[model samples]
Target: MRLSVWRIKYTQRSCSFLRSFHRSFAAAAAAGDDGKGCGPGVSLSDLRRAPACSGPLPALKPTDSHTVLIRTDLLRPGKAPEPHPSPDQLQDRWDDTHVKLPCSEHNLFPTDRTTDQRPSKALSVFLQGLQGSEAQHMFGELLSAMAQLALRAPRLLTQPIPLLRTQRCRSITLSQEQVSCLLANAFFCTFPQRNSHQTEFSNYPDINFSRLFEGSSQTKQEKLKTLLCYFRRVTQQRPTGLITYTRQCLQRLPSWSSSEKQFGKLHISCEGSIEDQGYGMLQVDFANRFVGGGVTGSGLVQEEIRFLINPELIVARLFTEALNDNECLIVTGAEQFSRYSGYSDSFRWEGDHDDQTPRDEWQRRCTEIVAIDALHYSQFLEQFRPENMSRELNKAFCGFVRPGVQPENLSAVATGNWGCGAFGGDKRLKAVLQMMAAAEAERDLMYFTFGDADLVKDCVHVSRLFLVGSVFRLLLQYYECVCKKTTRSRPQKTLYSFLSELL
Candidate 1:
């Protein structure tokens, strides 16, 4: 017997293919055939009953041994300053535990080419802008605020921030003011061992603003405007809310075969975006393993665009280590600051976004973002291997599962065709995998298809037709039949058609 291998390329026809299956299923259901091997579908109204995931914020104080809260008392104005403030006061006391402060003495600013002065051309550009006509009125006030932040860096960030390394479940919570001071130092390129040539922090995402300032592109300029706007706003009025970053590691993997979880309610749509429509839900960041993936450089996509709108998310790079398979980073209280239009190459910074996202019990913004990187495939067919599928299943489970929170308390996940774009993932397969994971985690899902109405209709049909275990079993069969040894080529049928026929 010969098995036919399929190379799954993302194309428009896939949507039509799913539509065909959907039509067939609907016809069978209408004919009173009992929709054999599938269950009654879920409705949008039923799914809405599951409350949006909110509340139960992490304790205001670091209640556990693994959590660290950066104390903010010293940040108060008129607080006694630390004695003997040497010129090298802000210098890095480098070690395994602490983030190397950008304002450190050893981290010299690149001298300007014209005058060989400190504060490289990039930093000078922004500093000069503070004095330019547009900001001339507030120049003195802004300059004083920035100076105060620079002077207080060493005193505020006194505790050694533990690096969120692999397999360690730890959290760091800091006041938004502390975040501002740290970002100010980044704007000045004061962070050490973060240049393109430097490898000291190679495993971590770049945090300094140098990369964002060096290149010249319309997108780059727009990004700078957004970031600069954030700085301006913070300087004028400091934020009092706190933000928390938790690195969660799953110790035991779920047994996908034996799980009997049913699919949760789904709210599928093709019109609105996850950020806008999925507000107050567990927003999913289709992330890169490095976390902030290319936001500091020339890349812009779902993850980067999200980071730009919510610059506070960028600070996660300072301490978050590269994510391992079983690990994910959950961020709560990072406020959004910008709203934009377009995507990737066409991305433009539209203007300021006033984040009125209400605060939780801990005085942190009621925003929760989960970062889970999908596996990138060189060849599209490589994703069909059972191991790869299992990895994806576990990865989504790690992101969706809330350990201490009861199933009823879990917030619904807002996601789209995760890993389907540049990663060349099959939207149909990924949607099923995510639904299954969300089901096992016992949470509803809000799926955004960007603009694929056919996908919206097809997924709604699938959610209505099948149970989680049935779909899981069918997917296993798909791996067994389609992924067996054979020549690699495009398949005549999609996973949708295969399941449709089987059911």
Candidate 2:
């Protein structure tokens, strides 16, 4: 009897509250902003002007298998994009890497840079804030961009390789001009990559280039010990296993934009260049939001590369001595990176990976090293002689940096557009923007440098780009699978049902 009485009372209270809310809403509707009911019916414009969806809008995903988070409202307009390639296609593309450069090549940068001077301050200082920071890896990003543009000759295949870098929200939102200046000032000095010089890409290493990530097998306990030492920490040997530099990311605050007040305002890049050997130059631009050839905000972000460069016109650098004439040459980390005169690598070049060879050609060859040097934004700036700097810069950026064999249909793809598609309407916007803003900054250089003369050959760039492209392709397939998997609420398995179960 008591329970029944309580229920009746609760129902009555809820009805009464609803009626009160209804009355209040009616009164507000009748009243104008002045609360006098003097104005005509109020328009819903105020609500319309309010921020859309309060918080972030739902992100778009290209497929269900993507491990990254995406927001649909952040989506950009781009191509429908062809389906991602299968593993066989990826393998074929990897096999297509070759040394196709013509023996004869020319200068790719301004002739005047040969006489540049050392700064009163230094490049190390510019990079002090970046060392080991999450942003440090961006050196590879910078190099890859330069090399991809030069060797692939995107215009020939008319391919689009989207370049993606993580930057602060403040930098991207605050000053678009600074973004352009940052890019323009960051001169290409190196292009490093893994297995790029080889005709094939492999996770394993050969006798030529010493492999760091591959070809080294350690026991699980030994691997654990390596990780502990790498992190410079000590931990208990638990019954489970060894522990190392592992931490969970705890996000607490909102992200700011990527523009810097200094770089954006000064409009010059004082960050220093990486020119160490011979030919390659990069042409860059400032952009707003770019999705490139495909949508990025959704599932597996991807873009298309459609350049048409002659295979024989691009040279391939080996990280070690070329195994054969056809084996491409790649320049990775400096044999002995320094801030002064030349450094040596002993009889066998040491460091992250060693390229020990007896041939005279291997003495100072820049092959068999990781391609971080291709366009690395190194902390040290005073090492290379001005001549060597110019030579290295020119070689990596020039069209002839990695001379070797290639198919005439080479192109690229990835996910960084710098908003060229959004700011203006042309694909050549980077080159045009460079002409517009920095052409006069070089004074005499205006006549000397051409877009073709400034490229970096980055092995890291090519490899990462390939990875991104593959991930994107997989995502498209994942999306299709997602659509067909669900009928009402149950999952329907297809032949590819288990593919999405991976990292």
TM-score of each: 0.82, 0.15
Off by over 4 Å in 1: 1-59, 63-66, 70-93, 103-132, 135-148, 196-200, 485-488
Question: In every candidate, how many clashes are there?
Answer: 4, 113
lDDT of 2 by residue, 104-169 (tens): 122232232321211112223333435575335434553344334333221121211111111201
- Candidate-wise lDDT, in order: 0.72, 0.21
Please state every model's RMSD to the true fold in angstroms: 7.2, 29.7
lDDT of 1 by residue, 346-435 (tens): 898888898877776656677789999999987876787768888999999999998878776666788999999888888988998999
Highest lDDT against the true fold, candidate:
1
**Candidate 2 weakest lDDT stretch, 10 residues:** 305-314
